[model samples]
Structure formats: C-alpha cells, structure tokens
Target chain A: MQELGSFLEVLISGLLAGVLYSLVALGFVLIFKASGVFNFAQGAMVLLAGLALVRALDFLTRLGFPGWLAIMLGFVFAALVMALCAFLVQRYVLGPLINQNALTMFMATIGATFVIEGVAQFVFGSEVYPLRLFPTDAWIAAEATFPGGILINKLDVWGGVIAGLLVIALALFFQYTKTGRALRAVADDHAAAQSVGIPIDWIWFVVWLVAGLVALVAAAIWGTKLGVQFSITFLALKALPVLIIGGFTSVPGAIIGGLIVGAGEKVAEVYLGPFIGGGIEYWFAYVLALAVLMVRPQGLYGEKIIERI
Target chain B: MGQFKTSYAKDMVIFPIRQDRIGVYLLLGFALVLLPLMMAFHVPPFRTDYFLLAILLPFLILSLAAIGVNILVGYCGQISLGSGAFMAIGAYMAYKFGTGISEIGLPPLPIVFAILLGGLSAAFFGVLFGLPSLRIKGLYLAVATLAAQFFFDWVFLRVKWFTNYAPSGSVSAPELKFFGYLVATPVEKYMVALIFVIVFALIAKNLVRGNIGRQWMAIRDMDIAAELMGIRPLVAKLSAFAVSSFIIGVAGALWAFLRLGTWEPLAFDINRSLELLFMVIIGGLGSILGSFLGAAFILIVPIFLTVLPAELGIPITTGTVSHLQNVIFGGMICCILIKEPLGFARLWQIGKEKLRMWPFPY
Candidate 1:
C-alpha cells in the first residue's frame, strides 16, 4: 500500500510537470502545422519571452510601479515583442525565402535560434533570476494516514490548470473562430488555402503570434520551477521528443506526448536511475519516442502520411 | 574553348583541364610545403606563433567531420543531429585502444591503426542509431539522433569504463607515435591532421563521384524512385551513415589526439553537433569544397572576433565579444540562407563562371 501510494504521488507530480512540456510542444505544433517548418528557435523564443518578461517586471518595479501593475505591464510588453518578432520573421525570413525546401527553412530557424538567444542575453544579461510569479512553498501538505504522504506543489497545480485551460481555449478557437479556421485550412493544404483566397501570409503571421504566446506561457511556468537562465533554453529541447511521440501536426498529440515523456522520464529516474547512476531523464524521453516511432511512424495521434509518386 | 580533351581517358580525369589540374596541384603543393618550409626558415608567424597552427589543426579536423556530415545530410538527405555522439564514440574508443594497447606491452601498433579502429567503433554505433532512419525520416530522424547524442553523453559521463575509470571522468591521449617518431609538436600535429583531411577528402570525392555516390543522390532526390530504379534504400542509407560516421570518427580521434590533448564529454556536446551542421550548411550542402570552406569560416571567425578588439585597443570583455559573435554569426547564417542558399561553393562556381566570361555580358 505504501509503495503504491508513493508511486501514485510520483505519477501525479510527473503528470503535473508534463503540463509544462505540453505547453512548449504546443508552440512547435502550431508553427509546424501552419508553416511546415520545424522552428528550432522555439526554445530560444521561450527563453527570450521569459527573459523579456522578467526584465520588464524588474524595470517596472524599480520605477515604483505596483507589483500587480508591473506583472501586467510585463506581460503586455512580452506580447507586443512577440507580435513584432512574428512580423519580422515573416518579413525577413518567410517572405524572402518562400517556396524553399523544408530543410532550408529548418536551417533558417536554427540561425534564428542563435539570434534569439544572443539578443535575449544581450538585452537581459545572462544572470539567473528567480521568477516569483507563484508562491514557492507547496500549498498541499502530506497527510500522515496516507503511505509516504502525497504533497502537491501549488505552483504545479496552477500550472496544470492554466495549461489545461489554454489547451481547451485553443481547441475552441481552432474549431470556432474564423481566423482559426483559416489557419487550419492553411495547415491542411497551403496551395488550396491560397487558391481559396485565404490570406496565407497573414495566417502565418497570426500562427507565429499564437505560438509566441504559447511559448511565453511555457516559459513562465518553467521559469517558476527552474528559474530563468540560459539552461531554460535546453529545457525547451525536451519538447522535441514530445513532438515526435505526439506527432508534428496533432495538437492533442502534443499534450499526450508531453504527459508520456514527462511521467515516463520521472518514473525512469526514480525506479531505474540509481542503478545507472542517475541523469537518465535526459535521454529517456527520446529513447521512448524512438521505440514508439518504430511501431507507429506517423505517431500515436498524427495523421497518416501518404506519399504518391 | 582554350583547352580541349582529345580522348575519353583525358575527359574522365578528376581535373580534366590542364589549368585546373595545375591550380589544384599548386594548392596541394603549397599546403604540403608551406608549414614545413616556414618552420625550417623560421618564419615569424609559423615559428614564433603557434596560434595559426592551432586554428588550422581544428579547422582541418572539423572540415573532415563536416565532409562526413555533408555525405549524410547533403548527398543522402538523412538529417542527423548525432554527429557529436559518433565523434565522442571515436574519441573515447581511440583513447581506449591507444591506452589499452600500450598497457599490454605488445609491439606498439601505429597510432593510425588505433584511430582507424576508433572510427570503426563509431561506425558501429552510427549504424545502431541509424536503424531508426529506416522507419522514420526528416525531423523524426533528427530527434532520434538527438537521443543518440544524449545517450552517448550519459554513457561517456556515467560509465567509467569508457573514461578508464578516471576520478574526473576526463581522458588524455597516450603518446601519439608513428613507428617510434613522436607526433607531439604543433607542426607535427598540424601535419597529421592535414594528412587525414587530404586523404579523407580524396576518398569522399571519389566515393561521391562513383556508383555509391549516385545511389546516395538518387535516394536523396527521391527515395521511392531510387528504390524503383533498383537502388536499395537500406544499403544506400546505411552505407551513407557508415561512411559518414567513419570519417567523422576519424576526425573525432584526430580532435582528441591532435588538438585539446585532454578532454571531457562536454567537449563533444550538442553545440558541437550544431556547429558541424552549420559548417556543412553554410559551406555548401552537396559540394566537398564547401566542407573545407565552411570549416574554415566557422573556425577562423571566433579567433578573429577575439583578436580584432585587442588589436584595435578596444575595451570589450570576452563574454560580450562572444555574445556579439553569436549574434553576428546567427545573422550571417540567415543572410546566407536568404541570399545564397547554395552557400559558398555555389558562390565560388559563380565567380569562376564570371571569370570565364570576362568582358562579355553574354
């Protein structure tokens, strides 16, 4: 019973952590679905957003703004910057290099990754800053009656709630909103959407903006947990395996894949890590994704890819 | 029109034009003779300064690795992010073979053989990680390769056997000797790297120009069509992986033995993989000349950035310089992709064409 309780607690914590992974993976899926380009800069975008927000908050607070007002202003500034980034990316990168191969676009994003990281470091400096958006102490205390007691971090719980809400909101927006429908049409077939008189470039811009918003949320959650640092960019790499397992174009796939990877790594680290000298979490998600991909090339929820020669 | 080949044998030569052949021979001759001549004559930069030699050695090693990556990514179209892992395998395996063999007190096998063995070991692991390419491709294959990168990193860091059970988990190359001649000095190391680069570059050029190279190009263009045309995807893809890994592994061994005499696992991390990929992309994807060009550009720029400020008596810190370097390098990559996606090799080709048609717009 005690072992089972401990396992349950670990599983819950892992799932909670998975929510953040899902948020980052969602950013990748949004960009990929619309543009068919793997944005390697997505991680850098997360880091940039977090760095911008924290710096903005710090600057605002130092100027005698209220805590709540500073937070609100920081978020608004981040949103504007992200929108500007989307526009600039469209103008400088996508517009000029239209109809290029996927690999070329992928390479461009890598360049964008370096630029974003450099800009972030240059603007905000490379110092590690603790994000105090949420309370540090766990809100839920362990009960003595339960075996090993199950303590839940309030920040994680809120993170899970926020992630769930974001996913739901996105789903509704995609299903109901006109712009979202256009975005879907674009993702479905770029030529078809363009032929139908849909504003392909505008849709792309909006999609990138949405992805940026998702990146901001993800960074916020991750920053609260790990603190804002250069290493946070690496945490974004965790989303890659999540995307692979979830399928590149599937929104729900990102969520499920994130959960699987997050829980799977935690479980592996706990049960199998000690024997192997720990740090197995780094590669565990990738290995799992690879194994799963062998069975389902299109991924668990990804649409089957059909090639006609 | 100035020079014409009369026979098919003459036409089939790697450099059919006499001028082209002369130019290539002159370049090779200069490379072979320049450093040794400079050292003998006590030339200022070559004698008093080891910095140029230091940069050249890694540039040569990285060029070789980039060439390997080019075969896989450019020629075969299998995007791999695990080149660093293969490099690690080569380096550690070479370290093991080099140290383990010497400990046994057998007749000392040449360092060249140990390096080859290190490359072969890397090839073995490359094939293992490459199995997923059969099932998935493109971005999926890339992520799978990332797994290999992380896995090898963990293995080299955690598994003590690979590092010879050192307390710090870092290993240094044993004395690199070729038949009792120690290759210890910077010039000797530079020569060693240059020799490997030249030999491997020749092999890569020949391989790409032949039947195997055609198979790889066929697969890269359209795998299904290649299969329909009797080119086995399995053999082509795996061979590409094997050959690419072999070259990369040798480069990795050279990197350990020639440069950075002592190293840890962090030396061959994801950033290294990204740097090599950038070299291949920025150099030219399918062209061998691009590999050398890309390697040279990536290696020299950082040194230049560091030294330029000092030379100008500027007061910038190293961190700021590095940060600015990243920004500039990143911007350059984007500019190259946008302006000339075919990279420097294509630019070189364009220059040559313009030279041929000088003073004639047509």
Candidate 2:
C-alpha cells in the first residue's frame, strides 16, 4: 500500500511534468505542420526567450520596480524579442530555401539552433538564474486516503495549471479565428492556400510568432523548476520523444504523449533503473517512442501519409 | 564546358580536362614524396608532430567519414542521425578484436584486419538500424536513427566486456603493429591513415559511379518511381547503409587509433555526428570531392578563427571567441544551404568550368 501511494505520487508528478512537455511540443507541432521544416531551433528559441525574460526581469528588479510590474514588463519585452526572431527566421532563414528538400531545411534549422544558442549564451551570462514565478514548495494532501500522505510539488501543480491554460488558449486560437482557419488551409496545401488568396507568408509568420510565444510561456514556468540556464535547451530533446509518440501533427496527441512519456519515464526511472543500473529514462523514452513508431509509422494522431508518384 | 568524347570509355574517364589530370598527379606527388620528406627533415613549420597529429591526420579520417556520410545521405537519400553510433561500434568493435582474441588460445588479430573487421561489424549494426528506413521516410527516418545513436552510446558506456574491463570505462589503442613493423611515430600514423583514406576514397568514388550508385540515387530522387522501374528499395537502401557504415567504421577505427590514441565514448558523441553532418552539408551532398572540402572547412575554420584573432592582437576571452565562432559557423551553414545547396562542390565545378572556357567566353 505504501508502494502504491508512492507510485501514485510519482505518477501525478510525472503527469504534471508531462503537461509542460506538451506545451513545448505544441510549439513544434505549429511550425512543423505549417512549414514542414521541423524547426530544430525551437529549443534554442526557448533558451533565447528564457534568457531575454530573465535578464530583463533582473534588470527591472534591480531598478527597484514593483514585483508585478517587473514580471509584466519583462514578459512584454521577451514577447517583442520573440516576434523579432519570428520575423527574421521566416524572412531570412526559411524564406529563401522554400522549395528545397526536407534534409536541407532540417540542417538549416540546426544551423540556426547553433547561432541562437551561442548568441543567447554570449549575451546573457551562461549561469543559472532562479525565477520565482511559481511556488517552489510541496503540498501533502489525501494523507488518510493513501499511506503517509501523497506528496506533491506545488511548483509542478502550478506549472501544470499554466500549461493547461496555454494549451486551451492555443486550441481556441487554432479552432475558431479566421486567421486560424487560414493557417490550417496553408498547412493543408501551400500552393492551394496561396491560390485562394490566403497570404501564405503572413500565415507562416503568425505560426512562427505563436510558436515562439508558446516557448516563452513554457520557459516562464519551467524556469522555476530547472532554473533558467543553458540546460533549458535540452528540454527540446525530451520534447522530440513526446512528439513521435503523440504524432507530429496533433495537438491533443501532444498532451497525451507528454503524459505518457512523463509518467512512463518517471516510473521506469524509480522502479526499473535500479537492477540494470540507473539513468535509463533518457534512452527508455526513445526506445518507447521507437516501438510506437515501428507499429505506427505516422504516429498515434498524425495524419496518414499519402504518396503519389 | 564542352563534350568532345568519341567513345564511352572516354566519356567515363575520371578527369575530363587535361589540367585536372595534371593537377591531381602533382598533388599526389606532393603528398606522397614532398610532404613526407619535409616532415622527416623537420622542414620549417610544416612538418611538426602537431601539424601531423592535430590537423592532417584528423583531416584525412574526417574527410573519409564525410564520404561515408555522403554515400548514405547524399547518394542514397536515407538520412541517418546514428552516425556516431556506427562510429562507436567501429571503434569499440575494432578495439575488442585487437585485444579480445588472445583471451582465448588464439593470437590477437592484426591491427589492419581488426580495422576492416571493425568496419564490417559497424556495417552489420548499420543494417540493423537501417531496417526502419523501409517503412519510415524523410524527417521521421532521421528521428528514428536517433534510436541507434542513443542505444549504442549506452551500450558502450555500460557494457564492460567491450572495453576489456577498463576501470575508467575508456580504452587505449593497442600496438600499431603491421607485419613486424611498429607504426609508432605521428608521421608513420599519418601515412597509414593517408593510405587507408586514399584507398577507401577511390573505392567510394568508383562505387558511386557504378550501377549500385545509380540505384541509390534513383531511390533518393523518387522512391516510388524508382520502385516502379524495378529498383528494389530494400536492396538499394540497405546496400547504401551497409556501404556507408563500412566506410564510416574504417574512419572511426582510424580516428580512435591514429587521431586520439586514448579516448572515451565522449570522443564520438552527438556533437561529432553533427560535425560530420555539417561537413557533408557544407561540402555538397553526393559529391565525393565535397566531402574533403567540407571536412577541411569544418575542421580548419575554428583554428583559423582562433588564430586570426590572436594574431591581430585582439585580447578576447575564449568563451566569447567560441560564441562568435558558433555564430559564424552556423551562419555559414545556413548561407550554404540557401545560396548553394550543392555546396562547395558546385563552387569547385563552376571554377573548373570557367577555367576550361577561359580562352572562349561563350
């Protein structure tokens, strides 16, 4: 029973962490569906966004501004930086090589990733900066229901709430707005979207901007857990496994995939890690994703790939 | 610039222009005779151990690895991110062959044969990992190959027997013995690497121009059309993975034995994979000469960047230098991908074409 209680706690925390993964995965799905570029630089963008926000917040705080105002202004400044990044990427990096092969596009994004990582680190000191946006404590509840009270991290719960809100907001944005419908049209068929008078370039820019914003929001919450540092970029690697499991194109898939990965890896790390040595989660997630990939090449929620000669 | 071939044999000649033939002969002569003499005689600053060990040795092996990568990615159209895994397999397997045979009654395998066997073992794993390429395509396949990268990385780190139970989980190269001759000096190591690189490169160059090469290219360009034309995707794709892994495996052995001499799994990590991919991309996909050009570019740019700043008496921190290097390196890759996807190979071909047509503008 104690084991079961601990497992549930682990599972809950994993699910919470997984929701944040879904948040990052959301940004990737946006760019990939719209651009077919994969945007390997998405992780670097998060690092850049996080650094910009933290550095700005630090400066504002040092100037003796009120806490709320500093946070608000910092977020605004970060969003502007992201918008500028979106414009540069869409216009300069991805625009010229529009019809090139997928490999070329992928490589270009990786190049962009290196540049972003380097410049971001160079500008903002490569040291960790703690952001107290969320509670760093834990809560003990349901003590009578489970042995020794199921422990829960307050930060994880709050992060989950924020990630959930962002996902809902994004879902609404993608489903209802006129621009959202146009983005879908562009994703469906680029040439057709252009022929129908949809501004393909504008739609692409909007998608990139939205993707950048998603990363920034997630970075805000995640900054509290891991601290804003260069290691924040590794979140992108974790997101890739979630991506394959959830299917590349589906929003809901990202959530479900994140939950599975977060819970699955957390559980495996505690239980399965001991006998065969620890630190299996990294490759365990990949192996799980590969198994899923072998069974369903497209993914659980990804669109069926149709081929014509 | 002009097609003046009278026969099929003439059309298929390695060098179509007279100057190209003379240029290659002169370059080979310099590498073979002049360079070695300069090194042995300690001629100026060109023949130091640092020059041989740090620059040229790695240049030869990395260029070879780039060709290996080009065969799969550039020619075969099957993208793989598990190249570092294949390299690890080659390095570790070759190390095992060198030391493990004597654990039983048999004598240890010769180093040269161990290297070849290492390549073969890597090829075997390559085929194993390449299995997914049959069903997966494009970016999906690229991600799937990550399975290979992460899996082998774990295997080498955890599996004790592969490392001959070294305490540090790292292994050192055994003797570089060849036919009762010890290849001890850096110069000797460079020569050995040069010989292997030249042989394998020629083989790669010849193979890419043959029927199998055409099949791989066909599969790359349009798989469905190639399938319709009776070019079996399985054979072409697997064969590509096999050949590419073999070449890469040999390069890996050379890298471990000749370049580092003592190394850990960290030596062939994800960064190495990215570096090799950069070489292939910046050099030009599907162009063998581009492999050498790309390797040289990727390898030398940092040295040049670091040195040029110091030479100019600009006192910059190493961190800042590295950051600037990253910006420049990555920007170069993006520019190359956008402006010239064919990369340095295209630039070289254009230069040659211009030279061929110098006397006549049109």
Candidate 3:
C-alpha cells in the first residue's frame, strides 16, 4: 500500500511537471515549424527570461512597487526583449543564410547560443538567482486521509490550466485567423505559400515573436518551481528529449511527449532507482525516447513517409 | 629511373617510392623508441617544469575524444552532444573495474583489461544512443543524443552502486604497471597514453580509407542517394556509432586512469562533450590529422592563454583568466568556423598543395 501510494504521488507530480515541460517544448516546436532552424539557444532564452524576472523583482523591492505590478513589468520586459532577439536573428542571421541547408543554420544557432551564454554570464554574474511568485499559499492540500494522502501544489495546477488554455487559443488562432492560415500555409511549404501571395517573411517574424513570448511564460513558471538559476538552461534541455518522444513538428506531440517524459522520469527515480542504484530518472526519459525512436523513427504523432523521395 | 618507378611492384609498396619508405621507417622508428629516450635524457630545466601532468594529460585525452567525435560528426555526419556522457561511462566503468578487481586480488592484467572492457561498455551505450540517427537529423538528432549525455551523467553521479557505495562518491585507480614496469610517473603515463592514441589513430585512419569509410561518407553526403546506391543506412550508421564510441571509450579510460587518477562523475560533464565537438569542428571533420590539430589547438591554446598572461608578470586573477578564456574560446571558434568551415585540415591541405608547387608561380 505504501509503494502504491508513492507510485500514485509520483504519477501525479510527473503529470504536473509534464505540463510545464510541454510549455517549453511548445516554444521549440513553434520555432521549428515556422523556420526549420533548430534553435540551440532555446535553453539560453529560458535563462534570459528567468534572469529578467529576478532583476525585475529586485528593482521592484528597491522602488517600493506592488508585487503584481512588478511581476507584470517583468513579463513585459522579457517578452519585449525576446521579440527583439527574434527580429535580430531573422534579419541578420537567418536572412543571409536563408538558402543554406539545415546543417549551416544549426551551426549559426550554436553560435547564437555562445553569444547568449557569454553575454548573459558577463552581464549577470555566474550565480543562481531566486525568483518568488505571488500567492505562496495557493497550494491545494489533500484533506481526505487514505493512508498518507498526496497534496498537489496549486501553482502547478494553475500552470497546467494556463498552458492548456494557451494551447487551445493557439489551436483556435491557427484554425480561424488569416495570419494563422498564412502561417500554416508557410509551414506547409514556403515556395507554395509564396506563390499564393502569403507574406512568408512577416509570418516567420510573427511565429518567432509568439514562440519567444511562450518561452517567457515557461521561464517564469519554471523559475517559481525550481528557483531561477543558470542551470535552468539545462532544464530547458529537458525539452529536447520531450521533442524526440513527441514529433519535432507536432504541437500535440510536444505536450504528450513532455507529460510522458516528466511522469516517466519521476516514477523511475522513485521506483526502479533502488535496483540500479537510483537516479535512472535523469536519463530514463531520453532512453525511453531512444527506445521509441528505434521502434518508430517518425515519433508518436509524426507522419510516416516512405524514404524513396 | 622513371620506368623503374612506374613498375606496379614498386608503385604498390606501402611506402611506395624509395625516399618515402625510408622517411616513413625513420619517423616510426623515432616515435616508437627515440622520442622516449630524448624526453628522458635531453630535457631542459624550463621544459622539464613545463611537462606538468595537468597540461599533458588533458591534451592527450581531449585529442582522443576529438578523434572519436570526428568519426561521427566529421565522417558519419551524426551530430551528438553526448560524447562527454560516453567518456563518463568509461571513467566510472574503469574505476569500478579497477577497484573491484584489485580489492579481490585478481592480478593487474585483468584489471588493465577491465579498463578496455569499460570502454567497450561505453561503445555499447553509444550504439544504443546512436540508433535514433536512423530517423532524426540535424538539431532534433542533437537534442536526442543530449538525452544520453544527461542520463549517463545522472546515473554515474547519483547512483551509489556504480561508485561501489563509496562514502565520498569518488573513485581512484590503483597503481598500474605493465610487465613489471611501474607506470606511476607522469612521463611513463604519457608514454602509455601516447602508445594507445597512436595505435587507435592508425586504425581510425585505415578504417576511414576503407569500404566502411566510403559508406559513411556516402550516407553523410546523401542518405537517399546512398540507399539507392545499395548502401545500408542501418549498417553504416551503427558501425560509425560503434567505432566512434570505441575510440571515445578508450579516451575516457586514459582520462580517469592517467589524468584524474581519482575523479567523480562531474569530470565527464556536458561541457567536456561540447569541448570535444568543438575540437572536431575546428579540426576539420573528415581529416584524421585534423583531429590532432583541432585537439591541440583547443587544449593547448587555453593553457597558452592562461600561462602567457602570468609568465610575463601580468598578474591576472584566476577568475579574470577564466572569463577571458571563455570570451577568447568563443571568439576563436566563430572566427575559425567562419574563415575555414572545412577546419584546420583544409589549411593543412592547402599548405601541402602549395609545398608541391614551391618554386613556380603557377
């Protein structure tokens, strides 16, 4: 019964953690879907957002600003800065290398990662920063006692609801709006979309802007969970395994994959850990993704194509 | 003389022309025996102090790791950020085997063999991780491989059994010797490492020149084209993973046994993997000699940066040195990649081609 209780608790936490992971992976998927450039700087972007939040909070405390206003200002600053980064990348790096293959673009992104890391470390000293979200008492306590009942955190629940709603809103936007239609058209095939008079460049710009905004939100929630730190970049790396298990280009796949990895890692750590001397949780997600990849190269939701093209 | 040189028998020789054969034999003979003798006998006082273990071991191990990476990224066109994880696997496995055998008094040969076996185990894991390459490409594949890196690091760091439930969570290598000659000294360790690196490098060079190498190149150039050309993607890709991992595994062993002699899991972290990848990229991906140049540049340049600043009485703090190191390292990689995306090997090739036409303007 104790083991069963622990397993349930692990499963619950895993799913909740998965929701946050989905948000991060969504940022990756959106960018990849619009522009085939794999943004190696995604992790750095998360760090940037978390750092921005901390800086904003510190300033608010000094200036005697309200908690809510400070938080709002931090989000605004993060979103604006990320959007600006997207614009710069699109204009300078991606524009010149528009005709280059995926490999070249990937290299360019790696360069971007170095620049971000170097600049960030130089500006903000290489130390962990703590970020506090408003409403600390928002956690949900399990009142019913059935052999050491699990109490789920309200912050996680709020994060899940917000993430789900955002995903739905995005789905709706893609389904209905003209810009969304154009974005979809571009994603399908740039040349084909261009021939039909869809402004490919504008669509690409907007996609990146939205993706950056998503990253900002992800950064905030994760910062609240684990405290903002430079190592948060590695946490963002958690999304890559999520991407592998989920299809690279599929939004739903990202969400589902994140949940599976989050839940899987947590449960493995709690259970099978003792057998292998524990901490299999760290790598279990990737190994699971690898196993899945071996079985189905296209991933869970990825389309299967015959390779003779 | 032209007719004699043109004979198939003379042309087909391993050293081909007479002068080439003589030069080859002379170089090998020196490297095998003469280099050791020279280092032992003719070392200046300043140079003797310069031969610090920290400086030499990182160079040797980093070069080996870079070669391992070059096989995958350079030859096979597989991008992996998990080479460090494989190294960790090797180190921990070696540590585990090294201690386990010695604790039970199972002789030194078996213990030494255990280190090689540790490397083989890492190779096994490498192939396991490399399987995803069959589907993913470019960045997705990079992310996928990264999972392997994180997993292995976590396993080795957090798992107690792997560390033999040691209280401090670090492992050490016992005194190693070969044929009753103690290899406890820095110079002796350097010689052992040099021997293994040379042997593996030769095997890597020969492998790259063979049918397997051709298949890897074909897959790299165009997987579809290669598949149409009757090359099996699975076979070619997996073999690349296997061989690459094998090389990396050995490097990991050297790192633990010789360099650290005692280390924890953090010794083979993600940063090291990135460093190895950078070595391959800066070294020229497809060239065997490029691996050495890249490794030397990456490993040696930092030491030069750190030392040259201090040697001239320029008193730079350690923190400042580290920060400057990052900035310079980042800037150099960008510059090198931008100037010669083909890497240092291409530069070597250009120089060689120029040497062939030394006196003529044409």
Model 2 lDDT tens row, A48-100? 89999999999999999999999999999999989998998889888898767
In model 1, where do residues sit more than 4 Å from their true spots? Answer: A140-145, B101-109
- What TM-scores do the predictions have? 0.97, 0.97, 0.87
Kindly list the per-residue Cα lDDT of model 3 for residues A1-309, writing each as its tens digit.
656666777798889889998998898888778777677678877777677667777887789888789778877877777877678667656666665667766766666666666565665556777777733344333426436677577778877887999899889988899998888888777788889998777887898788877877888888878777777887667887788789878999999998999899888888788777766766787778777777777678866644454
Candidate 3 docks with a DockQ of 0.35
lDDT (C-alpha, whole model) for all candidates:
0.88, 0.88, 0.78
Off by over 4 Å in 3: A1-9, A64-69, A91-93, A141-150, A172-179, A193-205, A274-276, A305-309, B1-52, B95-107, B110-115, B132-144, B158-165, B304-339, B351-362
Tens digit of per-residue lDDT, candidate 1, span A1-309: 778777777888898888889999999999998888899989999988999898999899999999999999999999888888889888888778767878788888888888888888887888898888987567434566675578778888888899999999999989999999998999888889999999988999999999999989988888988888899888768999899889989999999999998899999999999998999998999899889889998888888988778
The DockQ of each candidate is 0.74, 0.74, 0.35
TM-score of 3: 0.87
lDDT of 1 by residue, B141-197 (tens): 988999999999999999988887899988998898976889877777877888889
Q: Could you tell me how far off, in angstroms, the CA of residue B294 lies in candidate 1 after the best superposition?
A: 0.2
- What is candidate 2's local distance difference test score? 0.88
In the order shown, the candidates' Cα RMSDs to the true structure are 1.7, 1.6, 3.9
Clashing residue pairs found in predicted model 2? none
The superposed Cα distance between candidate 3 and the true structure at residue A274, in angstroms, equals 4.3
Better of 1 and 3 by DockQ: 1
Pairs that clash in candidate 1: none
